[model samples]
Target chain A: MKKSFAILATTATLACVLANGTAQAGATLDAVKKKGFIQCGVSDGLPGFSYADDKGKFSGIDVDVCRAAAAALFGDAGKVKYTPLTAKERFTALQSGEIDVLSRNTTWTSTRDSALGLNFTGITYYDGQGFMVNKKLGVKSAKELDGATVCIQAGTTTELNLSDYFRANNMKYTPVTYDKSDESAKSLETGRCDVLTSDQSQLYAQRIKLATPDDFVVLPEVISKEPLGPAVRHGDDEWFDIVKWTLFAMVNTEEMGIDSKNVDEKLKSDNPDVKRLLGVEGDKGKDLGLPNDWVVQIVKQVGNYGEVFERNVGQGSPLKIERGLNALWSQGGLQYAPPVR
Target chain B: MADQQGGVAKPPFWNDPTIRSVAFQIIALCVVVGIGYYLFHNTQTNLQQRGIASGFGFLQNPAGFGIIQHLIPYNESDTYGRVFVVGLLNTLLVSVLGILLATFLGFVIGVARLSRNWLVAKLAMVYIEIFRNIPLLLQIFFWYFAVLRNVPSPRQSLELGDAVFLNIRGFYLPAPVFQPGFWVVPLTLLVGVIATVVVRRWAHRRQEMTGQPFHAFYAGLGLMLGLPLLAFALAGFPLAWDYPVLQGFNFQGGFVIIPELAALLFALSIYTAAFIAEIVRSGIQAVSHGQTEAAYSLGLKPGQTLRLVIIPQAMRVIIPPLTSQYLNLAKNSSLAAAIAYPDLVSIFAGTVLNQTGQAIEVIAMTMAVYLTVSLSISLLMNWYNRRAALMER
Candidate 1:
C-alpha cells in the first residue's frame, strides 16, 4: 500500500506539471497570427454544412465562412485549417483556444450568447425545426405524428424545439436520441424511429445520405425558428469583429450585385458604392484593423454569400434547398447586411 | 563504548526516528493539500475568465428534452434534477442487471473450465479466450451496429407466441398489470422468507447438537413458492398481462427495451464474465487438493466434499478480485454513452454538461457518483471478506 501511494503521488505531481506547462492563455488573434493559419471548428460530416470529400477537401457554406475569414485576414483562403467538432465539443473547443473560430452550423440562442461566453457573428442559414418520415409510414404532417417514435440529436436546440412543439400541440411521442446526427439519420432509415426531427436544412442534408433517399420525404410543418451562424469566443472583440464582418462583407457584396465572377470587373466601374466597397473611395477596413482591400479579397476569393450558399447547399447543390427566408431583404427575405460606407 | 557506558545523551531532533516520521507525514499532507488547492484555484480562475456560471442552481431548470426510457414518470417539463435521477436510475439498473448476469455466467463457465470432461473444459477455455481478448467497446458496437441493425423492422418483427416481439427498434414483452388485492401475494412471500430464515437457523442448530440432517433447502423452496401461489390463487388471480399489438409505426402497450440498452447490457455482461471466469477458476484451483482428499477419506460424497470443503475455502480467494470486477462493470456502464443508453454519463455529464456549460459542477457530480459507488462496493465486499477470511490462532 505504501509503495502504491508513492507511485500515485508521483503520477499526480507529473500530471499537474504537464497541465500547467501546456495551458497558455492569450489573445486569439495573436495566436492565429503566430501560427500563420486560422484553426476553424466545423461539423464532423454534415453534408451541406462542413463535410470532407473523399480526398479530405472540405467544401460547405460553413467551410466557406472560414475561408472568407482567412481571405480577409491573409488574402489567401487556403491558410485556414479545419478542426471538425461534434455538437457537444464546439463551444468548449472555442473557449479553450483550440479553435480560432467555430463555423459548425451552430444555432444562436440567447442563453448561448450571454451565458457560454460566445458571440454569434451573423446568420448564415435561416432554418426552422421540421420532420422527416419514411413514405411508407403515410405520415403527411407532423400533427399526425402523435405517439410516434422520433429520432433526435442530443445536446441541441432541435431536441428542445421538438419537445416544445409536441407539448404545445398536446401530442405524445417517444424520443430516441443519438449524439450524432448521422446516427439519428441512420436510426430513422432503419425504421427504428418513425420520424427524424432537426432543422429543415439539416433534414435535407441528412436525407441525401440515406441508402434510398427517395424513400423519405420532409414534412411541411416547420415548428420553431433556428438561426444558424458562425461564433467566436467573447473576450476577443477584435477577432470577433473580423469574423463577423467577413460574413457581412459577403452579404453586402451579394446585395450590391457583385460576386466572385464579376468582382474584378465591378472594381473598374464608376459607381461610388462600388468604389467605396472596393476600397477605392473610403477606408472602411482601417477601422477594423484590416487592409483596405479586405472586403475585395473576401469577395474575390470566396465569392458573395449567395454564390457560397448556392454552391454548397442551395439550388446548385444536391440538397436543392430553396432560399425561402435566407434571401436578401429587398428580395422578400430576412438576410440583409449593413452598407460598407 | 564510552557513550554507551555513560548512558548515551538524547539524540538530536533531526536524527530522531519519531521526529523524522512525524515530519515526513506532515510534509506529505501539506503536499496533497497544496495540490488540491492549486487545482481548485485554477478551475475558479478559468471559469471566471470564461464567464460560465458555477453553481448547482441549474439543476432546478427545466430539462426541455425527452428521455426514451425512464424508471419513474418524467417529461420534457421536468427539472434537470429529475433528469439526473432518471440517468442515475438507468445506470444503476444496467449495473445491477449486468452484475447478476455476469456472476452467474462466470461461475458456470468457471466450473465448466475445471470439469473432467475434455470437451466441456476446452469449450469454456475457448469462450473465455475469445471474449477476454476483444475490447468491450468493439463488442458493444458489434452487437448494436451489426447485430441489432440487421433485425427486421417493426412491420416484419420476429414474433414469439403472440407475447413478445423483436425488431430493429427494440424488444417488446408483456407487461404485468396487477389489481388492488395483489398485495396478498407479496405479503405471503414475505412471510415465507421469514419462515425460511427461522427454519434454516433451527436446522443448523439441530445438526450441530444432535448430529442429524434436515432438508432445509426443500422446505424453504416449498414454503416460498407454495405460499405465494396459494395466496395468488386465493386472490382470484388479480394479475393481468398487457400484450403488445402492432400499431401504426411500432408496437404499443407493452414493456419495451430499446436496442441500445439491450446491446449495452449484453456486451458489458459478456465481456466482464470472461474475466470473472478466469478469476473464479484460479480461486477454486488455489484451494489445496489435500482438503478434498481428507473429506473423501471421511466418507463424504463428492458433492458434499466439493460444496462443504472446496467452496468455503475458495471464496476467500475469489471475493477480492470479484469486488474489483463488479466495480469495473459499474464504471464501464459509462460506455453506454457511445451507444446512447441514457446512462448518467451520457445524459447528465455529456448532454447536460454541454447544454449548461457547467463543466465543473457536472463533472464533479459525476466523479462523486462513481466514487460513492466504488467506495460503497468496497465497503460491502470488505465486510464479507473479513467474515470469510481464514481464522488463525
Candidate 2:
C-alpha cells in the first residue's frame, strides 16, 4: 500500500512538473519545420474551395495557399500535408496543433478570433448568406419565405444568422439543420427543405449538383457578411506572420500586375515599387526571416492572388464566383495589401 | 517432519516468490504512473508557455453560438455549463425513447421468428438479416439523405389524417398545450398505480394464506381506472386536447419535430431493433421445452402457459443481453451528429469543441457524460435482473 501510494505521488508530481514547464514553447513550429512540411486543414469536399478530383488529388484555392506556404518555407509546394476536415472538426484541429493552418473557407468572426484563439490571416473570399429554392415554388424573394422550411448547416454562423433573419422579419420558420454542408445541401436538393441557406458561393456549388441545375434559383437576399479567410492558431507569432504575409504578398502581387507567368519578366522592370517587391533593392525578406526571393518563390510556385482564384473558383472554373468584394483595392473592392517595403 | 522442513526452508523477503511478485507489480505500477505524469507535465508546461489556462474555467464563459433544437431555453449568451446540461438531457431523451421503441419492436419480431406460421417466421428472418447486415451510419445517412429529404414542401405537405402534417421541414402535430387545471390527470394516474400495488399485495397475501388464486390483475385494473375517472369528475373535467390544424402554407399551433431528429431516431431505432430481436429470440429458445409442456399439462391455456412458465424462465437469459443492447443504442445516439440532430455529441463534442478549441476538455467531458449514462443504465438493469433472478429461485 505504501509503495503504491509512493508511485501515485511521484506520478502526480511529475505530471505537474512536465505540464508546467517542458511542453509549451515553440515546440509545435519547430516540429513542423523539422519535418520539412506544414500540415494544412481543408474542407472535406467543396468544389472550387477544396475538393478531390477524379484521381483523388486535392486542388482548389485553399489548397494553393497551403502549397504557397510550403514553397515559401521549403522551396517545394508539394511539401504540405493536407488534412481534410469537416466544418465541425476544422477549428479544433487547428487549436490542438493537428494542423498548422486552416484555409478551409472559414468565416472570420469576433468569437472565433477572441474566444477560440484563432487569428484570421486575411479575408480571401467576401461571401454573403443567400437562399436557393426550387423554381417551381414560385417564390422569387426571401420575403416570401415567411413560413418556409430552411435547411441550414448546424454549428455554423449560418444557423444563427438564419434564425435572426426570420425572427427579425416576424416570420416563423422551421430549420432543418445538418452537421455537414453536403448533407444540408443534399437535403435541399432532395426537397427535404423548402430553401437552403448558405454562402452564395456554396449555393452555386450546390446548384450544379442538382438533378436539374436550372430547377433551383438563388434568391437576391444577401443576409450576412461572410469574410472567409485562412486562420492560424494563436500564440505562434512567427508562424502567424509568415502565413499572413504570404497571403498579403499574393494580393500585392496581383495589384501590381505581376503574376506567376510574367514574374520573371517583371523582375527587370524599371518601376521602383515593382523592383523592390521583386527583391531588387530592399531587404524585406530578412525582416520576415525568409529568403530574399520569398515573394518571387511564392509567385513562381503558386501564382498571384487573381490567378489562383480564377483557376480554382472564379471565371476559369465551374463555380464562376465573380471577383466582387474580392477584387483589388484599385479596382473598387475590399482587398488591399500593405506596401512590401 | 513436514513442519520442521517448512520452518527450515523459509525464504528471505527478497528471494520469496510472493514478495517478488508484489515487488514486480509495484515496479510496473510505478512505470505507468511515471509515463502518465510525464505526459500531463509536458501538456501543462506547453500550455503555460503558450499562456493558455489549464483548468476548465472556460466552461463558465458564454457560449456565443446558438443551438437549433434546445429542449431547454438557451441563447447566444448561455454559459457552456448550460450547454453541457442540455446535451446530457438530449442524450437521455433519445435513450429513453429508443429503449422503449426497441423493446416493443424486438419482442414482436423475436416471437415472430419462432412463429408457427411459415410466412411470419420467414418475414422476421428477412428483417433481421437485412437490418443487421448494414452499418448504422450508412443507414442514418440513407434515411436522412435519400428518404426524409424527399418530403414535400410545407405548402404541399402530405397530410396523414387531419392531426399530422408531413413536410420537408418536419412533422407537425397538435402540441399538447397543457392547461393549468390538467394537473389532476397525472396525479390521478399516480394514485391509480398506488391502488394497484395495494390490491396486488392483498391478492398475493390472500393467495399465500388460503391457497386460492385471486384475480389480482382485474381487481388492480378496476381500482386503477376507477380512481382516475373519479378524480377527473371531482376536478370538473380539467383536461382538454389541442387539435392540430393547418393554416395557410404551413401548420400552426402544433408541436413540430424537425426532419433531422426524425431521421436520426428512425434510423437508430430500426437498426438497433434487428439486433435486439436476435437477442430476444435466443433468450426465449434458451428456456427448455419441458417448462411449456408441463404448464400445458396442468390444464393452463396457451397464453397462460407461455406467459407464466416460458417467459419467466426466458427472462433470466434475456435481461443481461437486453441491457447491453439498450446500452449500445444509447452509445449509437452519438451518430445523431451525422444528421445534425443537436444531440449531446453534435452540440457539445462537435460544435463546442470547434468553437472553444479545447479538444482534451471537450472530449473528456463528453466521455464522462457517456460513462455516467452507461453506468447508470447498467446499475438500473442489474437491479431489475437481480429481482427477476431472485423470483426464479
Output the number of the TM-score-best candidate: 1
Q: Which residue pairs show backbone clashes in model 1? A: none
lDDT tens digits, residues A313-333, model 1? 988899888888999998999
Q: Which lDDT tens digits does candidate 2 get at residues A274-313?
A: 9888788788876777777888988999998999989988
Which digits, one per residue and each the tens of the lDDT, describe model 2 over residues B243-349? Answer: 55666445676778877777778778888889889988998899898888888889999899878888887888999999999899999999988877878898889
Least accurate stretch of 10 residues (summed lDDT) in model 1 chain A?
Answer: A16-25
Model 1 residue A99 distance off true place after TM-score fit, in angstroms: 2.0
TM-score of structure candidate 1: 0.93
Task: State the local distance difference test value for candidate 1.
Answer: 0.89
Lowest summed lDDT across 10 adjacent residues in model 2 chain A is found at A19-28
**Docking verdict class for candidate 1:** acceptable
List runs of model 2 lying over 4 Å from the truth. A1-8, A15-21, A24-29, A136-147, A164-172, A286-289, B1-10, B16-26, B50-54, B64-66, B75-77, B247-249, B390-393
